[model samples]
Target: MSAALLPPSLSSIFSSSSSASNPYPLHCVSPPFNLAASRPARSFLLGATASYSDPSDLSLVSPTSDLTVQALDQKLLTLLRQRKTEDAWIAYTNSPHLPSPTCLSRLVSQLSFQNTRSALTRAQSIVTRLRHERQLHRLDANCLGLLAAAATKAGHTSYATSIVKSMLRSGYLPHVKAWSAVVSGLASSGDDGPVEALRLFKAVTRRVRKFNDLQIVSNSRPDTVAFNAALNACANLGDSEKFLQVFDEMPQYGVEPDALTYNVMIKLCCKTDRKDLLVFVLERILELGIPLCMTTLHSLVSAYVGFGDLKTAEKLVQAMREQRTDLCKILRESGSEDLVENDESVFKKLLPNLTKQSDNEPPLLPKVYAPNSRLYTTLMKGYMQAGRVSDTVKMLEAMRRQDDRSSHPDHVSYTTVVSALVKAGAMDRARQILAEMTRIGVPPNLMTYNILFKGYCMQLQIDQARELLKEMVDDAGIQPDVVSYNILIDGCILVDDSAGALAFFNEMRAKGIAPTKISYTTLMKAFALSGQPKLAHRVFDEMLNDPRVKADRIAWNMLVEGYCRLGLVEEAKKIIEKMKENGLYPDVATYGSLANGIALARRPGEALLLWNEVKERCRVDKEGGKSDSSIAPPLKPDEGLLDTLADICVRAAFFKKALEIVACMEEHGIPPNKTKFTRIYVEMHSRMFTSKHASQARQDRRIERKRAAEAFKFWLGLPNSYYGSEWRLEPIDGYDSDSL
Candidate 1:
């Protein structure tokens, strides 16, 4: 453990990148914080194979009934943690008796991180059954964390809060980690009212103080951590003074600033890019003689990057390298072995954070070819984060010199670059990376090949993906993992090969990669998109047997959309109830997608009802906060997508319904733009004349044209948006003006 002592409060800064796989590790700022500060040589050895940490990590600290089981559990936890939840779940399902609840809990907790919605549900059901059966020897806090996390991830934020609340009532009150979790949950969810979260945190502290007053006033205060969390809450509030106070509390409360603390502060300072305070905090941290961590460096780099201040970030990036080297050097010399002793925080599984890769600035490595074979893998990961693949080759070439060949660049380097290339839709680059991996005698891991297969499958190159599957069997002889099979199933869906994909899914199940939600979602969307909503519902039923797939919102949303398209509003309503029963909450996208579905069904009145529901949702949910995305580009109530739905409605012989939808769209704020107005009058009339609807809707088109004339006049009078000349388009030769 650290001689400096554990602080009473340790704030966690969740620095999530955009990539699902590349989560920026929580930059925690707790005194005497070091990468290996408390992790033993055992954790490192296990990290190599296990690839992640399990909730039962603390369980492994004590003797288990089965030592072999314990070792495998450790390794499994590592894998789950490393954005490998599906792989872990597959292993758990295939294994006998399974790693204990705590072990499963860690994987469950990581569901959010892994985006394993299905796995989270299965694990939760297991936990529920275990509790009902009175199978617990002791309550595992880690499991509770996972439960709460899953609740939130499933979009039941209120239920997640309830889980945390119940945990406290069940005598787990001293753990502030849960409070921090709620903070993180709120932050990522873009939820409103963090002030309530802070109050709850305060209540927890008060309870702790009452229980142990002397400890509360100790030298190691957790103020730094808690204050940082408060500061994070401030970011949402945009409360500058409160934000500053949170920053000032780091030292005032005697809690030393660690990487996460700095990261939180850095983001807060950069929120407005107010340079005066930014310089002060930067100088203050340097003066404290505490080493600045990578998160803070990234934040600073990003902060300056925002103002087009690459020159400043570039200079600091160099300084950051110096700091990283110094810290690494200190760890290297600090007996390199003392890192094995520290910690008093309770173990807990966590909620997932959706992170994208964040390494796309200037190159961090030098052009010079001094290949530190040892850091080659690290450099590869860095390059991948920066979204570069060619650099991976450069590093590999450097490794070739001086016989520095260390077999392959290990999974980290390979997966990093490969994952990035795949996400950027650069299949060619991904293939090149895979080829280079094999060319250099570094046989690609099954995971690496999966990445390539997934990329190809996404681009609808099922033939190529299948060919690689054959290679895995013949040349590699490696069995496919669940993800490997999932990709193939998804590819089949894209090609409307439900029969084939179902066969593959069955094969996967036979091979023991038990189907997850994804297996069914593909089939559902495939059938639904193919105009077979009935088949979609049936697949959803079969998927529910897995427990995890039951009531999944993603599945529900697909079903709702499909049913809506078929004008099966009742079925769509049923799908929504299933979603809510599963504790999933719908977001704007979910609502927006469903609303469009209603319009397609010629249910303009129903669509308007759903639209009003959205307005209400937006009102109370000021929490989802405006996204950093371009401010929605001025959608008119009567414009954009309604036109498409109107077209569909008209095709379905719902002429009056199509006009109603158009009217609703106008009522919504997308009043018909010029093109839409023109289309409603001229385009619809043309299409009606061309199609068989002319007899019934021709008079309606005449009425629409009269309204369009007034709308055109209004649009022409508008300032910059007016385009009278553009609207003239030769007056649609021979168009009957008398219709108006």
Candidate 2:
């Protein structure tokens, strides 16, 4: 077969080259080539030779050129057949003429199959070369699909998408495995990835439909896996509407929803804050007779825990522990059945929306799943979140008492106990949990120690945090990661120790641990809080220079904060503009810092401008303008920011603006601090309008200010009348009226 692949003239040359007695013939005779030439030069030479061997212009090709092309092709084929990918790549690149489509495809298949970064790069190079040569269509579908999957696995989702799009543009529909990989990769990529994943899914579905109508058979039609990937993206985005749209489209494409499909639905429910539909989803799953899986059960418990409905989560876990097959009975026992029943309108938007079962309908039943360490840990997490330290400890004890080995407390369980204790400010108890973990042979990982470090840091016990860091390395032989350093840096910020924070930052770098965005941002925070805005700015600049870390919103906000902390409102506003230029709009924290800076700078007019911008961003266009969609979602001002701005307005005697800020506070459900404002008004404006100016314009301005003051007093529910004396000159018992 190898001999047949070669041209007759080259076959003899290959036979001569492979002579066992003279195996190193090329080395012995430097015939027509420079054997010492670089590999790239050899490739260029081969390509140049192959160009002359084209069959379309055979008359122009000499037999010598044909022989050279055949010899190179044979070499590439032999190397590929032996699975020597590196050598094959060398031979293929050095060849003057492109190899047969079959040979090229086989090479690509091998390279992609290796799944190493270098091999994937070489495979992508081959594909790119083929694309440049307008021969991409010659590669087989399986080869292209494998390349796409390999790229996706390597975290190059955009590259993978482009490959799939290339396949489509070349009139070849990609296989499900190919496009699905791209979709799943995009979905998990974070940021706007999920949105793009949904778009890709829809694009391919449309193409498949179009092809089906044209009587073309294509395996690229989205299957259950593809649909699930799309659904998971929706769950990530909290797009319940898009999720349902994709979910309902499954039946139209003849794809059945699987257990994972329903699992994503449960997550979507949690994400969209529709916890009331949890039971309804379970009922629908039961109605569809889908086999229950442990993940679905875990997701339900996790969703309930996230919603702070720990009772429902506990009931489910308890039922599972008791091996109750009728899980619906557990739902009823938890008393959330009524809530689910009352929310039919919520459930109807999804599937079956089962509320009350028919007389003949079978009840929802689940397999008896023994509670695993993860489920118990999740419950413990809920307790930790709710500040129930004792309950979290008890839950850990329950896990230890469970009979099943899978339910036995693990490192995560121990870590949760430590986290709960730390959150409750019981640092000693948290350390004791660490000791218990060591005693029980469950090794505390980096996360456990980091949690303790954070606990110590939060209490401003930087010394203990440092001690723990040393212990992590020397005692446990566990190296501190980026998170450990971030915690320590933040700890320094708490105590206003910028130098200490910088020491930790340098030490972290010295130890070869790359600082992440969090590390840089936390360090910036240290400098910012210490009133060293220049140092913070320097750190921010360094963060931008670091290739590994991208400055996120927090980092930008910290820079704004540093400037604002020093009452450098102009510098802060410049940073904000730069932040917007970088595609990040100022969020609540950004505005909060600016408000504080404005108050510090005594710039009430600037406060009014800031308020207008805030109001514009927060404006809801009831008319559904296209411009509104382009605007960022409204900024939800926290009480601190609102109070800062309002205080500035009140102090500056900008009473009308002050009233507007107060109204905004009430609109957002934050009650204005009337007592504080009333005190400020009485102290600052007690003698207002007492004297009239001689100039008419000055008097007119005074009158306006007084009326505004009166309106503000009226709003504060205070007396609008003046405090000046009409009958207040009388002396009490032993006091002198003249002196008063």
Candidate 3:
């Protein structure tokens, strides 16, 4: 891919080659090409990965006048295949010819297979440029399909979704393979991806059917791969109906379900506690003569073990061992005659006792012929589910004792145990496991430190979190990133250590570790809640000056609210206009602050108008209209804002408006409680009695008492006649109505 394939956000990678300030450890795998070992130097390789802004020297190609565009393209591809990545990239970039979309697609395909950070970055740039610029209209089905495939392989789900959605919105439906890649990426993410994937699948299918265009429908139809992705999505999200619907639709799509497909279905059935469906899927697997891989057998074992059916699980395990021995014997007998007699399968039951193979025993089978780690890990998982922590640890230890490195316990195994301990609130035990990991020659990395940091924060042990942060650097020798700092700051704020949070914030900046949006937001909120609004503004202004840190909607809202809390309504209003100019509309927090500020500034009418505008925007957003000024989803009327409105109404002597405000609160399910309403009523009369005409009222005692009585009756929402004689109103614990 040429430089034209670079995304705008990625263009920076080409300009700067320095990696000095990077907190993460650099681990580069040298390629066959004579490329520089520096991080940026290895970023993009021609025909594999390429970024273009400054044109390469075209003189080299112009000297060879006979080099046609086709010949140059072929030469570049050959160089790439020969692992001369840099040479190929230089030649391609220096060539004067505009490469075809097919050539760009081929380059993207190469980049996808490489699981390096550089390769992933290059793939994103290429996919973005392809979809947004440079003949997007001319993108054929094959090109679209390959783009999604590349994104999936690179784990760029957001980029993949953007490409597909952009195409769909422009009436160019994606091919089945493209749709499958997207669904698979989202399903595997384990976040809100499951919900989004299911929604996208339904919307696309419905839209395709509604259009009823034969070509478009056929090209964009969901296949077994797509269905499998959707099924996995449902399984992750516990959407049982959606799972079964996808399972039942396989044959309708004329696609045969494979063993992996059945594995996922059985897993889902096990997860959803549908023993009947589990049996049904297992029976179908057998009926179809689908050779069960270890995954299928493991799922079966795990389900049985999970439900306390260990008697049946033991039988199933014995049967699986027998089957494996038979298959191995068959392979030894049927293949190479050069095999030694000792090559025959030797079966043994190594249970409960964890030990390495004896010196007299035959050498273990190669990794390709050995059982995968998951087969045992599955049993460990079952023991975990049964709450047998000791048993699970023993199983994990047994795996570690094995001779083959491939069969040893890995990071996932250790992390799983640590995660389980953390969830059970056994932080000490989890920390012990982390130490054990290092003792076993598996040194703890950034992820290990992060898990510990999060555990400390969740427990509200800010001091402990701070100590861990130091240990991560001083002992573990791992550089803490922005996430590490953010966690510590958040933990401090949770413990009301505002000064400590600010110290950490300053430390982060001094270390040249740029604060992210989360970092700024954390500090902003901490100071705001700590009643240091001026300091919050200082933080916001600092964020604004830093080019690397972009202030998001949350940051802006915090700035506005902080100003309002300081009774700086005009300052808050000025910030709102700046927010709009930056294409960020004021959200609920901003409006809430504005309303409160208006009331505090003695402008009740304007406050009412601002509150109404907020409601109107909320209504527009809720109905799914394109609200021009809507930056976020609508929120309920803020509690502080509601109280302020009530105060404003009482002070202005607009009792009718005050009642309406209370009614609105009831409709919104956040009605002002009795205690708050009574306080407001009392405050209203206190203000009325302390008026400028108090001296004159004292001279005319009878008139003063009459007016006070009438006001008290009005406040109680009673008829005027109720104040006549039966219910005589008097100042409580006071000398006189005017003097008190």
Clashing residue pairs found in predicted model 2? 43-94, 46-96, 47-96
TM-score of 2: 0.73
* Per-residue C-alpha lDDT of model 1 across residues 85-139, encoded as one tens digit per residue: 6777666654444576666657656653443544444554444333333343233
Please, what is the TM-score per model? 0.51, 0.73, 0.56
| lDDT by residue (tens digit), candidate 2, 431-466 | 999999999899999999999999999999999999
- Per-candidate local distance difference test: 0.53, 0.75, 0.61
Evaluate model 1: give its lDDT: 0.53
Candidate with maximal lDDT? 2
Tens digits of per-residue lDDT for model 3, 346-403: 1111011112212222221122334446666666666666677787778778887877
Task: Quantify how close model 3 is to the true structure by its C-alpha RMSD in Å.
Answer: 15.0
What TM-score does candidate 1 reach? 0.51
Strongest candidate by TM-score = 2
